[model samples]
Target: MPIPLPSLDDHDFDDLVGEARALLPVLLPEWTDHNPGDPGIVLVELLAWLTEMQLYQVDQLPQSHTLNFLRLLGGPQWSPPDTGGLDAAVRQSVAALHERHRAATADDYEYLVRTTWPEQPQAAGLPRVRRVRCVAGRNLAGTDPAAAAPAHVSVVVLPEPGGTADTHPLPTEALTTALREFLDPRRILTIRHHVVGPEYVDLVVSADLALYEDAVPTDALADARNRLREFYDPFAGGDTRDGWSFGQSVYLSEVYAVLEQSPLVDYIENVRLTRTGTDDGTDADGIALDAHQLVRLTRVDLVGYDSYGRTHPSTWELPA
Candidate 1:
């Protein structure tokens, strides 16, 4: 007969904690709890408890830190050994717990950009759009749209080739140089680069900026937008047609951005901007500009992908 695994909700966390507390004194004699609420003290107790559970479950003794204990508990890259010393088993269990927690806490952001400008009927004939995919790494990437950190920001742009324009090749060396120049400590402008391809040019960047709360200022935001405009201006100039232009703007600040049919020049448009502080005055969605009124935008329907991979309208505010 096989034993069924218990669901997380079904596990008795309180009983597990109690059993670990009872064994802690035997394992770590020097450890003391002067203040139970202390963060450090709490962490130590938690580790001690987790280690005890590992020992009980595997019927083994730990030789080192609790990491091995976790690895044995079905963590990534861990497999049950035919036989092992008590220490090895304990270490494995600890490692397994760490891996599980890490994966659960990891965050990911994804956005899709699409063509929103209506297709025009030309006498000479409309240019054929090619679809190409190019992935380039970003440099000096910040967690925010505006790269704020001195050396921690990087971005990767994926260009779709063949729909409206030819794919522009983004070289690694060019990106590194651009990052270096964009991140010049003296300049307020944070430079970000993207590669556009066959039918549409889209810029996608991401960074883990720790100082996100203090970095997003009005000046920084303006500079970031301007730099993006300059980065894509050359491509825009080459593909100028009466009704045909760059797609709508989509920016992800702090987390993600999704824009539809943005003017080639409007890099900061349709931003779902977020700030990391306690100020409620900040808007989650940045200032909205009417695409038709502000930029003579031609509304062409587009398809967008949700986090779950379902397709929907590309418009930011969908019709009721």
Candidate 2:
């Protein structure tokens, strides 16, 4: 008996092609004229069209060559064990197609290079710095006096750098340097640092200071603290906290000192002292604990230097 074929609706196929075009433009901007009227181009386009439709069943191919071409493209998702003899035949056809087209597409070499080159960094200056507390909770330990005590600091900076032209490059560079530092066998603990960019400078830096696991004799901790104090003290002090509070607020202040010294941060702004709390029975004994906190660093209406020298407010919602 002859095999019955699977057919796709014309309108459904068109819709799938349209979706692929829309998605491809954003990621593959150079492939603007992908649908030229050539037999090979048509075959490739049809394969993409089928993929967009989520039609992975191989028996649906209108021609054996179509199945072979898809397999040659390394589309293992479409090739199943049940495909039997069809798989071997497709592979042979695909090998022939490659031999024929290999020389013709050699001229496309330049286009390929241009498309793959990394994007240029966006111009941005240093970022405004702020610090929040890393409160303790279930992740750290059971109820202890220090569990209630704030252990490590949560450094917050703003405006949150999205992969914009300005901030992305700096963070990329900073992340690289940080990873290198982290892998150093001589280094016992991971040192924390912020890579901040200003609206002015196009490049980002490491901001030179490190948050040490233990106090070091060198300038790393001292410089970091001094830089943070200069940026944080003005807004963090005073009515932000009433009467005497556990020196936990000071933890952010110390973190600010580190950021201030960082070469990456251009300046500090909209600095505010916010509180983080936790009810995880394990706290107060200086034992490590995991906790969540609210951060308020930037405000919507304000720009540089508020009435009290606060820069602007940008807040973040972190998971508990």
After superposition, the stretches of candidate 2 with alpha carbons farther than 4 Å from their true spots are 1-250, 262-272, 277-312
Q: For model 2, what is the alpha-carbon lDDT of residue 23? A: 78
What C-alpha lDDT do the candidate models reach, one value each? 0.33, 0.34
What tens-digit string does per-residue lDDT give for candidate 1 at 25-104?
89877756636796755775687667656655664334543545455456578654557765556555655444312111
How good is model 2 by TM-score?
0.15
Looking at model 1, residue 107 earns an lDDT score of 19
lDDT of 2 at 13: 63
- Model 2's alpha-carbon lDDT is 0.34
Q: Runs in model 1 with CA error above 4 Å?
A: 1-61, 64-68, 73-76, 79-229, 233-320
Model 1 clashes, total count:
51
- Give the per-residue lDDT of model 2 (tens digit) for 14-57: 66656666776798776666665755447657876766556545
lDDT of 1 at 3: 67
Worst 10-residue lDDT window for candidate 1 reads: 102-111
